[model samples]
Target: MHKNFTHILTSLVVVIAITSCDIGDNKDVNPASSFLKIYDSHQFDHAIGPVDVVQTDTEGYLLLGNYRRDDTNFLGTYIASVDSRGEFIRNTYVQGSNVHPVGKFLLLGGQRYFVSMDAVGLQGYLNQVDDSARVVSTIALGVTYPMYAENDGTDQFILLSYNSVDATTVLSLVSADGSIANQSAFGIGAGQSVEEPIIDHFTRTGRELPFFAGRASSGLYYLNGFYNYTLSLLFSDLSDNNPTGVVQGQQDEGGVSGLLSLDGGQFAVSRFNFGDSYTNALATLNASGTTSSNDIQSNPMLEWEVDAKVKMISLTLDGVGYVVIGTTTKNQQIVLHFYDQTTGNYVAVDYLGFSSPYQLGAIEVTADNGLAILGSIQVAGKFQRLCLFKVSEGELLDLVQ
Candidate 1:
């Protein structure tokens, strides 16, 4: 399953385009019949990409992340606001040269926060933008990638920073106005960083933890390390380190490079098992930083053991639970998992697969009640055209149709 890492690197680039969206969740309906392409760019110029889409509470979506003009090029942070119909309302680009942020734009309360991990020296800034993609406020966190931003549920933001040099992690509480209220670091020389650290969910009380899934000292096997909310250390023993528990489990866990939080105190760490053998396992966390004691506790959620290598996973649990999974398959085939929020189970839906491969770069669910898919399409076998897929509640339900 070892691929030419060099070639697969192109999957990291995201391109953008706009189109009209039809509303409706009837699974038996044809999504394309009412699907319109609002913004489509055959090239990356004047085009923003590597975009992370988030829906606002007002039914508008904020497309946040960074975009590059070309290979080895860096684009500053970007936040584009789109209506529920997937039409662009406004787009804003942050002021930075080499600051290419690498994680998804996080939404807390009514504000949108994105970190500039690609910026050197200073960590990055947390941004607050309005529905029109205007920067409301910005706060700086020293040297942290995949910064975990969450609202304490009371107009407060809990920001976590991971310091690879000291092998330590820190947590801070910033007010809604982008001011730091409290800060603390738990681990000193415990957390390991392989290139960068990945932070997951935070509680309304300003608690968060980092989930590690990098290689072990052996350099042959993989390891999973869990850090506490206060950035304290936990899960030290490698005895139970096997991601799937069975140490020699046939499934390869090395490709799992990121972690994400699910609503109701659950977090799913994604691992690319290489090739079509990709698997995402759900881990339930307790207030004390321990995971549920279930072997493969929940369903694998996604099991694409054929042609797709899942690259990014987006979860929306506020309303009806839905998952948008992006992949590296040449066909650009994306899988949407819809579940009953109350039951934490899939809602028995069917999605018609697109015949040709489409490169799905990044997918985000906005607070405005819509979903945005950003990526490039190969036209006539030579054009890397930017394309977007917008789905409403009804349009989502129409997938099964």
Candidate 2:
């Protein structure tokens, strides 16, 4: 599919109200932006939405997530549907087996789909869910131990997995019917060391290690993950699933924390080493056959710094271009800084989650040209629950100006 840089962004979504949460011991409400309300999830002990959310044809939403039953390592799959106002309607859960779920929901042929592991056999599961928050069918995948997934904006999805026994990283192109179109593997030098972290991805700061796979605007298939013992952005040849060039990194500098491939082959790249993380809003991708972490760090276009997760996305709004950067700060806040897409000049900034702590997860440009943000809120300053915030077009324009 041709990359639509002008289209709307959507994903796993839940919005908040100005009400106190029933699950927490402390009732802290974020009144920072009247338009920014954190949704309450009272049923689940813990709910995290690193998954995908899509707006239904009705202008409502279908959100997918991972929920822990009782603070265990295992996380069950949870699904919910909400109205256009971000009000909740219905939801369901698929109990966990071993590891946390990965990947966003894929919208294929007007149907909603997602790929993860089946709890019982621990096999890959291609699930088809209805807009009404129902899992209609699930096809078991031959590709096991799945890690991350992303749609090529066309028909197929980029699936990232691991071969624990072989100590290799697996990459596959999966069709809508749950069939593998093309697959490849590369050795992970220290196999057990890499595999152990993936198993613990859900429980810990899953943010430390980021997995990205997508088709860039330059018509290149690229994946940023473990390859040959290191985390590198491996750009592939057009025909085969093989790296033509690589933008490699060291384990010491924390590898690529967030990557958003922009037009003209450039990208909004962010990296984290230990506690500090920073982003280069306007950076190119032609890594010299062997680029390293030092090369990315030498970039002078530093946009912002944070001690937590940093994410970015590019969008063209009403004739103007923007590279929006969202950062989770060490100070218990989520800050959004917008920059001029063409010049990389700073435009505006907004803050969320004042009283209670928040960690940024996902962001989207809603169908109405508004903004949809996904974040995990510490309810009562302790219980972690998923929350979504939508900024109206009027509010967005005010910030842009």
| Candidate maximizing TM-score | 2
lDDT of 2: 0.66
Give lDDT tens digits, candidate 1, residues 1-401. 22433223233222122221243445564443223233333233443444455666676566665555333334556666767555667666566533555344555665566655445454657666788888787666544543445444456655555666655545555665556665544343343332222322211122112233222222221222333322211222223322222111111223333334455545444443223233333444332333322322333434343323233344443344555444544334555554443454445443322433455556655443445666544533333434557655455544523
Q: Pick the candidate with the highest lDDT.
A: 2
* Model 2: per-residue Cα lDDT over 95-168, one tens digit each: 54533556667877778887767555567788888988888888877776677788875688888876667776
Model 2 alpha-carbon drift over 4 Å, by segment: 1-34, 42-44, 47-50, 70-72, 96-99, 202-208, 238-242, 297-307
Summing lDDT over every window of 10 consecutive residues in candidate 1, give the lowest-scoring window.
Answer: 200-209
Q: After superposition, how far is residue 155 of candidate 2 from its true place, in Å?
A: 2.0
Model 1, position 259: C-alpha lDDT score: 38
Kindly provide the TM-score of model 2 when superposed on the true structure, using C-alpha atoms: 0.84
- Stretches of candidate 1 off by over 4 Å are 1-48, 56-58, 69-75, 102-110, 177-330, 339-356, 359-386, 398-401
Worst 10 residues of 2 by lDDT: 4-13
lDDT of 2 at 269: 79
TM-score of each: 0.59, 0.84
